[model samples]
Target: MSRTVSFTQMKDGTREEYELLRDLEKPFLRLTADRVLEELRRQEHVTLEGYKVTRLEHGLQSATRAERDGADIDWVVAALLHDIGDGLAPQNHDRMSAEVIRPFVRWDVAWVVEHHGIFQMLYYAHHYGWDRNARDRFRDHPCFDSCAAFCERWDQASFDPDYDSLPLSHFEPMVREVFGRPAYAPEVIREGHVSPLGA
Candidate 1:
């Protein structure tokens, strides 16, 4: 068995107890990649809105397209996970998925994931009485074109059941590698000219 802190309240925790808790966090933190992959697998069974493919298939298709288009690992992983939250938070899945990958990916990749939902509206929002051009609100934002390109090139077109999508297993290694990097690494922040947390 492992050691554990006994403090009932955070304010009452001693330095030794806090140290032990911090040590205990290491293994759990290391498992973050595994947990994320498991969640993606869980999405394999999630179907929505009469789409021709399951959420997992759609994610794989998107990632496949990104990889084939020569997108970097971060962008490919972002494509793979851009809709991971759909099964749990359909109303705001984009935000939820964005938050999951935000800490580990580049600023532009996270920005695309965060706004892809609105960009996707360019396809069919008008069919539901919503403005299909709702994405226009962000037209002046620096990442706007990138997000639009993501939706147009990979996301919206991923629903094809016959598309030759790569298997989830094919992306597992990339997912692990991407997640293994330090969250908000100095290089990513400096290259993107963004804050540590990409805020």
Candidate 2:
């Protein structure tokens, strides 16, 4: 079964244009997967090593991990777009990624990527010495747990230093991939995803 990203262009029950994609729930979604793939493949970005990795490289690595883990397209896409907010300012990148991809990707995908940094913050918090309780206190957001699980499993090694290991431009299609197939649900996240920064 294919899954699709759902959205209403107009809130007044008016007709609106939207993109089509697939998910585990439904198998026959109306999406230009090839076009999205082409668009993703054409992106141009380099890694800190001066290697031309492009947004495609990041997406691929993330998606590869997600797919191997039995994830769906949306989850894969989320893995791909997890870093797309770097195109904007430092503090606003996540918001930027969510906003930019909201139109084309699933809400869940957008949320994960937009909140990815918080996961990193948690990672560093634990890594730096914060315990689980302290890290939870530091997370301080609704998306913290979900983002942390996303980071633990789907989020890949970011080769782009310009975007802090993960770059905003790398998140375009990722939003779609991840939202389609995620490793954890909100409940699972709330229950078991919190790993104290480094413990």
Candidate 3:
């Protein structure tokens, strides 16, 4: 059997125990892409009750759109994962999905993914007696326009079963490349930079 930490509480862990854990965590950290892929694959059957396409198809379509539009890796990966949290957090899936890609993608990409849900309200919120322009509250934020464009160009328009979305295999390498980066790397996050979503 492999060695295990002996601490009953995290604070009581000795340096050696913590070191051992850090060593053991390397493989788990490297396997994050696999776990993300697994979660995405699970969405194949986790359809929203009324959508014509499954969640996986919607994501594949969005990513395909981004790729065909000549978006960079960060944008493409963010597009693919922007709705990944739908299965577990339908009401706040935007934020959940953002968190999934935040560590690997740029700040602007993460911001757009996080807020696309609000921006998307422009499409159907008014029919529900809600303010369609609710997203206007963030109009002055740096990523506001990008978020709006993301909803308009990718997220909201991706539900068609007839769309020729690329298969998950096409994006698997991009997913692995992004997730394979060192978590929270400053160069990867670019915390305050707002790169354009366009090609």
Candidate 4:
């Protein structure tokens, strides 16, 4: 049998046991990109009820738009996976999706992903008797404009079934490259840097 931790409770674990677990976790961590791609494939069949395209197609179109707009890998990947949390956290998918990429992407990109839902409200919230200008509350935030542009340019415009979006194969390499980085590296995160929406 493979080696296993001996601790029955967290407090009872020894340093050696924790170290073993950490070492074993390395392989799983390395396959994060694979798991993420699997999630994206799952979206291929998951349409948002009445939308014209599947979630997977929406993501592909968004990513394709970002690429065509001269965006960097970070922005492109962010655009593609920004709505990934919709599968499990519909009401709070923005934040959940942000968390998935927060470790691998720039702080500004993660912030945009986390808050895009509210910014997106600018498009349809008023139809539901909600304030369309709710995003104005974040007007003072450094990433506010970026989030707005991301919504207007990529997210909201990606629902068309007729859009000629690039296939998932086109973005697989980008997703792998981003996820392959050391998680939460300070240089990668660039906490206070606000990269514009496009190159």
Give lDDT per model, in order: 0.85, 0.52, 0.91, 0.95
In model 4, where do residues sit more than 4 Å from their true spots?
none
lDDT by residue (tens digit), candidate 1, 80-185: 9999888789899999999998888878778889999889988889899999998899998878878877888888999999999999999999999988888788
- Model 2 off-target regions past 4 Å? 1-43, 48-55, 125-143, 156-199
- Report how far off residue 129 is in candidate 2 (Å): 11
Candidate with maximal lDDT? 4
Model 3, which residues run further than 4 Å from truth? Answer: none
Winner by lDDT between candidate 4 and candidate 3: 4
lDDT of 2 by residue, 118-145 (tens): 5566445666675534435436665566
Candidate 4, 60-80: lDDT as tens digits: 999999999999999999999
Predicted model with the maximum TM-score:
4
Ordered list by TM-score, greatest first: 4, 3, 1, 2
Candidate 4 minimal-lDDT segment of 10 residues = 1-10
Which lDDT tens digits does candidate 3 get at residues 1-199?
2479888999998888888899999989999999999988998887768999998999999999988888899999999999998888999999999999988899899999999999999999999999999999998999998898888888899999999999999999999999999888999899889987767
Total residue pair clashes for candidate 2: 39
**TM-scores for every candidate against the unseen true structure:** 0.91, 0.48, 0.96, 0.98
Output the lDDT of residue 144, model 1: 83
Residue 113 accuracy (lDDT) in model 2:
75
